[model samples]
Target: MPEKVNGIVADAIRRVRTSSGVPLAFAGVVTGPTTLRLQHFVGQHVGALSGLSVDVGHGLGGKVVALNRLLAVDDYLRTPQITHRYNTLIEREGLRAVMAAPVIVDRSPVAVIYGAMHTPTPIGGRMLDALASEARAVEQEIVAARARMEHAAEGENEMRDRMTAAFARLRDLAGTVDDARIAEELEAITRVLIAGEEPAEEPTVELTGREQDVLSLAALGYPNARIAETLGITVHTVKGYMKDAMRKLGASSRLEAVVTARRSGLLP
Candidate 1:
């Protein structure tokens, strides 16, 4: 997992543990294509869970990962919906009731967060909601982090392509030009390009808090009216913020602005 995702997961575990009144809250990030490794936790008696690997479709957490949804069991050891491969570990940890929510990104499970009770007590609806909310929050963070990385990779490729094109143009000009001094200058410019001098940086664009909020919602595929409803602002005000953000980003459309802002690390 990326550092950003790890940080978010850690914070989410703490928040879930406190807000949900769960004695144990732990997060397992996907360590392989079909495996989740318990990485972070809160609460005592969780030492046995450290570095535990939950395979997809095997344990309570694995069921969540396999199904990509929230799951709860009143008695984990007696749960029939999931396999009992991790029963030994669960028994060692003295956990009876368990709940798990999957952190999904792009419709795939990226991690699983679990909350458990030492006694066979059913988790409340509010606690379940809180755990699911934390999982969703982590999912959103992972999605944004992945988008930023992809955008950065695309930018690097674009820069390299532009540099290569410029170098070729300079070389072509140097070959066709008759003036030796101009040709030498062109060659010198090509040398500078080959040395990797970057182009002039674009002016930094700063968006206000509201502008950022609107754009972030837009990036998540929310319409202006929905964004307005979410932020408790008027649709007209949402449009205004979107317009301002688009102008600052030099984007010709809403999607363009969202892409640019995400690439610039202005949206999360």
Candidate 2:
């Protein structure tokens, strides 16, 4: 069971106790797949609540635990359909009309709550709806917390991988580069990659390494014919590369593409 669900359960008990004037308010949490453990019990005597793990389909709580639904009984001592184990607590607390509601999450029952009174009265449908609403709110909080944790985990993993790859590159180039200037340049690249900066370029106009090469020349005031001649491609092919580059760079004109490339460090 999620921790947030417990808060909702405790709050629900308070709500029921306030509205119904019932002294006996208890919360039962499922310890395992088949065992419903009494988590919180409030009354004159809570001693009977100890070691109370009802197995599925065995005791009064077991029936409630097994059914995964709310239950009520006006006559606990004489309910032939239910077992007699919890009768002691019921009798001790002067509880007669015992109410139980199952806490459900992801279509599975994870916990159960019980409220009892010395006498019998029909537990209202609105109270039941309140119980269900509280349960759903807790489930939503649990799911949202899980999603945030998973997203953080993914970001941590990505940063770790990028740092590992950067170190490997530096290690490979260590012997060839003896100057401090080259080493400082490599460290700066490492910091930028670790920070998750997207090259200061618009993601809508993301560019390929080769496409960048083509655009830099275009930005340098070269015509398609001249660019194709210099780069060993036809004028039509040059136009195609420029089109793709412009789309990625978010540039409506040749001047904008060059500026975008320079800012992104692709041209520089």
Best by TM-score: 1
Clashing pairs in 2: 205-248
Tens digit of per-residue lDDT, candidate 2, span 1-268: 2565566566666765665556777776777888887766555444666557777776566887778776777677777878887677667767677777776777777777676766766666765566555556555665676688789999975765455444435433533578988877865664454345455754444566447546656655678897787666788888888888888777898878877765675553
Q: At residue 261, give the lDDT of candidate 2.
A: 65
lDDT of 1 by residue, 25-103 (tens): 9999887788999989899675888998888888889888887889999999997888999888899999999999998
lDDT of all predictions: 0.81, 0.66
Residue-level lDDT for 178 in candidate 2: 82
Mark the regions of model 2 whose C-alpha exceeds 4 Å error after superposition. Answer: 1-8, 19-21, 42-45, 166-176, 179-268
- What are the RMSD figures for all models against the true structure? 16.6, 14.0
Provide the lDDT at 209 for model 2: 42
